[model samples]
Target chain A: MRILVLNPNSNPEFSAQMDKAVEPLRFGGAVRIDCISLTGTPLGIETQRDIDAVLDPVCDAIAAKEAEYDAFVVACFADTGVASAREVTSKPVLGICEGGLSAALNAGERFGVISTSNEARNAELRLIRSHALMERCAGMEPVNIPVVEMMHSNELAERMVSAGRRLAAQGAEVVVLGCAGMTRHQALLQDELGIPVLDPVVSTAAMALGAIAGRG
Target chain B: MRILVLNPNSNPEFSAQMDKAVEPLRFGGAVRIDCISLTGTPLGIETQRDIDAVLDPVCDAIAAKEAEYDAFVVACFADTGVASAREVTSKPVLGICEGGLSAALNAGERFGVISTSNEARNAELRLIRSHALMERCAGMEPVNIPVVEMMHSNELAERMVSAGRRLAAQGAEVVVLGCAGMTRHQALLQDELGIPVLDPVVSTAAMALGAIAGRG
Candidate 1:
C-alpha cells in the first residue's frame, strides 16, 4: 500500500525531517510512504493565515495524488486541509494531530503536547476542547522556535527537553510532539522526561497502517 | 446527530441493559441515540458461528436503516460484521469491541478484557494479536457465565469483580467489559477493582458523536 504524506508548507527541509522521522515506522509492512511539501506557502505555517493560504493547494495536491495512494496523511500539526482532503478521498485520510491524540489516548489518560510555538499550542488547545478531550489533556507546551529553524538547530533538543519537563510537571503521563519537525526528538525527550513520547508523523503513519489493515 | 445502536442479537432484555448503560453518556450534546436489537438471531452470540450467522442479517439491517441515522454501532463484543457494515455505508460504523478497545487504550497503558466466557475471551485475544496491540493488552479474564444470564443473575457482579481483580493481578491498569450485556456492572466493577472500567456502548456512543462532529 502506498501512503502519501503531505507536509502542507513550502519548507523542504522540515518535510525531509518529517520523512526521516517516519522512516522507522515502515517496519515489516507492505506500506510505501512518499513525503511531499506543498509549495506556495510560508516557510513555516505559524499562523491561521498560513494554514488558510495552503488549504486549497494541499487539497488540490491530495486530489491529484489520491489515485496513486491507499491512504493520505496531513502531516502538519495544525491539521490544515484535512477535512477537505477527507471529503475528496474514499481512502483513509488522517491528520497528524488527530492520529497523535488518538495514540496518546491509547498510551495514557492525561497527555501533554510539545509544539513549535505558542500559536501552534493554541491551535492544539482548540482541537482538544472541540474533541471534548480537555478533561484528559494535561496541557500544551511550546518550544518557541520557528518550524524551519527546528530542523537545523541544536538548541531544539534542549528546548524540547525543557518543554517536556514542564509538561510532566503538569501531570502529563504521555507527551505528544505537536510538530512534524520535532519528530526526531521523540526518543530523547522520552528518555529525559521518563514518559512515552509520541511523534505526530510516526503516530499518523501507524494509524494509517491500521486503517489500511482494517480495510483489507 | 442521531446514532443507531444495534444490539445484534434478539434479546430485548440485553438490548434494554445496553440502552441503560449508554444513558449516562448522552450528556448535553445534539446526539440522539436509539437502541434496538436485531431480530431472528440467538439471544446471545457466543461463538464464531453465531457471529458469522448474524453478519448478513446485520448488514441487511444496516443497509435498510442507514439513511435514518448519522452513525451506526454494532453493539456486540465480537464486533460482528463491522468491516462489511463500514463498507456498506458512508457514515461512521463502529463495533462495540473496537470502540471499547479504543477507549481502553485511552484510559491506560495496558488494558484487560473481562469477558462472559472463555470463548468470548479467546475471540478478543485473537483480535488484540491481530491488531498488533498484544503488548498493550494485559490479558482477558472470564466471568464463567453465559451472556444471557449475566444481566439477570445476582451473582454476576461478584463474579465480574473477581475477574477484574484477576486481570489487575496480571498487570491490567484498566478493565474493559467484553460484552454489551455487562455494561450495567461498569461503575460497580470500577469501584471494586480500583481501576477505570469501560462500557462498550458508552464508549461507542462518544466515538460516534466525535465522528459526526468531525463530519460537520
Candidate 2:
C-alpha cells in the first residue's frame, strides 16, 4: 500500500523523526510511505482552530494526491482533520489518536496520557472519548511543556522519563507520549517505564498499513 | 464529586444498548454523572477479561438510593442494575450511548459511526448517531458482526429522523459508533455509502455532563 502521512505542521525535524519511527513496517516491502510537513501551518501545537487551519490545506493536499496512495495517515497526535480527510479520500485516513488509543487501550484496561500542556487537555479528552475510551484513562498528568519547548528544555529526556515513571506508578501499564515530538524516544521511555510507550505517529502509520493490507 | 459509570453485562439487554447509543442528560441539578457500558468483552458484552470486570462488586447498587443523591447516573444504558435498588442516590448514571451520543455530538458537528458487525444493517446508523445530535452524522455503516445472538430487539429503536441523511448529503462533520450491536449498522458502509456518525459512548457522556456540571 502507498500511504501519505500529513504532519500538519511546519516542523521538518519532527516530521523526520516520525518517518524514522514507522520505517520498521516498510521494511517488508509491503508498504510505501511519505511524510509531508504542512507548508503553511504553525510550527507547534496549539488549539483546534490552529489544527483546523492547517487541516483545511492538508485536506487539499490529500485530495491532490488521492490517486497515488492506497491510504493516508494524519501524523498529528491530536488527529486534526481526520474526519474531514476521511470524508474526501476514498482511501482510509488513519489518525494517530485512533491508532494510539486503540493500541494503548487494548494493551491495558487503563492507561495514562502525559500531556505537553494544560491547553492540550481537551484534545486529549476528546481523543479518548472519540474512540469510546474515556473509561480506560487511569489519569493524565500534564508536563507543562510544549512540544518544541520540550525539545529545547534542559534535562528534557530525564523530565519526560520522570513523567512516564509517574504514570506507571499510577498503575498505567502503558504510557502514551502525547506529542509527535516524543516519537523518537518511544523505546527509551518504554524501557525506563517498563511498559509500552506508544508513539501515535509511528503507531498510526503502522496501523494504517496494517488496516489497508489486511490483518495478516 | 467522584462519579463511577458501571457497565453490567451479566445480561446484555441494557449493556448491549448502552454500548454505542446516545442518551440525554436529564434533571440537571447538582449532580455528577458517569457513563460506561460493557461491549468489547466476551459474555456477549459481559464477562470482559483484562478490563473492569472486577469493578462490579465495588460499584455496589448505588442506583436505588436517594440520599447518596447529590446525584448519580448508572453509566449503562441498559440500566442492568436499575431494579431492586437501594441507598439515597439522587443523580443518574447517564449510560444511554445512543441517547447521549445523539444529544452531545449532534449539537456541535456532523457525527457518524462505524459498526463492528453487519447484522444491524438496514437499521438506523444515522438515527442513533443523531439522537442527541439534530444532525451530527457525516456518514455511518457497519463492518463485521460478532457471535452473540440478540434477544430484546425493540430497545434498539427504529430509525426516525435520519441525522445520517444530512451527514451523507453534506459530508458528515464527524464519524464514529462501533460496537457489537451497532455492528449491525457498521460505519464503513455508511461512509462508503456516505453517512457519518460518531458513536463515542464514554466521551459523549463525559463531555455533555462536564459541559453541564462544569467539571471534568
Candidate 3:
C-alpha cells in the first residue's frame, strides 16, 4: 500500500520531519510513505481561508492519483480539509488532529491535547467538539511555543515533562503532543508522564493504514 | 447547510424511498438536501466487491461538489466506505452504519444491526471487527429479504417489529435498521420495539449535523 502524506504547510523541513518520523513504517513493510507539501500556502495556518487554500489543490492531487494510493493524509496540527478530501478519495484519508484524537479515545477515557499556539488551541477546541470528544477529553492547553521554536528551545524537554505531569494531575490519562515538530519528544514525554504521549503524524499514519487495508 | 446524500445503489425505488424518509430534516430548518443515486452500480451492495465498485464514483461526486456542499453522505445499507470516508473528510461525511452504531453506543451497552439482505448482514458482521463496534454490539442479523422484495412483503412491518423485540430481549436498548431503504419505518418500529429503532440514514444525518454544527 502506498500512503500519500500531504503537509498543508509549504515547509519542506516539516514534511521531511514527518517522513523521518514515520520511516519505520516503510522499513517495517507497513506501507510506502510519500510526503508532499502544499506549495503555494503560507507556513502557518490559522483560519478558514488557510484551510480552503490548501484543499482544492490537494483534492486535485488525490483525484489525479486516486488509483496510485491506498490512503491519503492531511498532516497538520488542525487537520484542515480532511472531510472534503475524503469526499474525493476512495482510498482512506486522515487528518492528523482527528486521527490522533480518535486513536486517543482507544488509549483511555480522557486525554490531554498539548499544543503550540493559541490558534492551534482554538482549532483543537473546535475539532474536539466536532469529534464528540468533549465528553472524553481531559483538557487542552497551549505550551506557549511555536512549531519551529520547539526545535531550538533549550527548555523544550523540561517544559514538556512539567506540562505533561500537570495535565496528568488535572486528570489526563494520556498527553497528546499537538504538533508534528513535537514528535522528537514523544518517547521522553511518555516516559516522564508514565502515560501515552500521542504524536499526531505517527498515530495518523497508523490510523490511515488501519482504515485503508481493513485493520482496526 | 447543504448535505449531499448519495444512495450508493442503482435502485431508484430505494432512492425515492430514502428521499421521503429524510423529509423531516427539510422542515427542521435551513438545511438543503440532495439525494442522488450512484450512476452505475448493482441494485444492492452486500459484499466487499460491491463496496469497492461503488466507493470511487460515490466519493468522486461528493468531492466534485465539495465547494457547494457543507457535508456529504453515503446512504447505502452497508455503510461500506465509512471508516475510509472518516479518514478523508473534514466536512463531516457520515455513513449510516457508523452513525447508527454510534447512536447505539449512547442508547445501550449492546445493540444489534438488522439488515434486509444476506450480503448486508454479512457486511455488518465484518464491520463489527472493522469499526471496533463489537464491544457495544450484541450481534447482527439479516431479515433475508432483498430491498426489492420489501414492496411485495406485507409482513415487512410485523417481521421487523418481531426482530427488534428479540434483539431487545437479547439486551439491545436500540435497534439499528441497517438498510437505508428501511428508514421509513423508524417510528413504527420504535413504538413497537419499546426502544430506539434507529434509522441509519436519519440518525447519521442527525449525528453529522449535531457533531459539526452543534446539536440544537
Best by TM-score: 1
**Model 1: per-residue lDDT, tens digit, B5-94?**
998899998878766766643433334688999889988898889989999988998999999998888998887888788668867787
TM-score each candidate.
0.55, 0.53, 0.53
Which one wins by lDDT: 1 or 2? 1
**Candidate 3 local lDDT, A24-93, one digit each (tens):** 4453443588987878786756555776688777777778878888778788867676777767854567
lDDT, residue A37, candidate 2:
88
Compute DockQ for each candidate against the true complex: 0.03, 0.03, 0.03
Per-model i-RMS in Å?
A: 15.8, 16.5, 16.7
1 or 3, which is superior by lDDT? 1
Provide the overall lDDT of each model, using Cα atoms, as 2-decimal numbers.
0.76, 0.53, 0.68
DockQ category of candidate 2: incorrect
Runs of candidate 2 exceeding 4 Å displacement: A214-216, B1-216
Candidate 1, what DockQ? 0.03
Pairs that collide, model 1: A105-B106, A106-B105
Q: In model 2, what lDDT does residue A174 have?
A: 68
In model 1, what is the error at residue B152, expressed in angstroms? 0.8
Report the poorest 10 consecutive residues by lDDT, candidate 1 chain A: A207-216
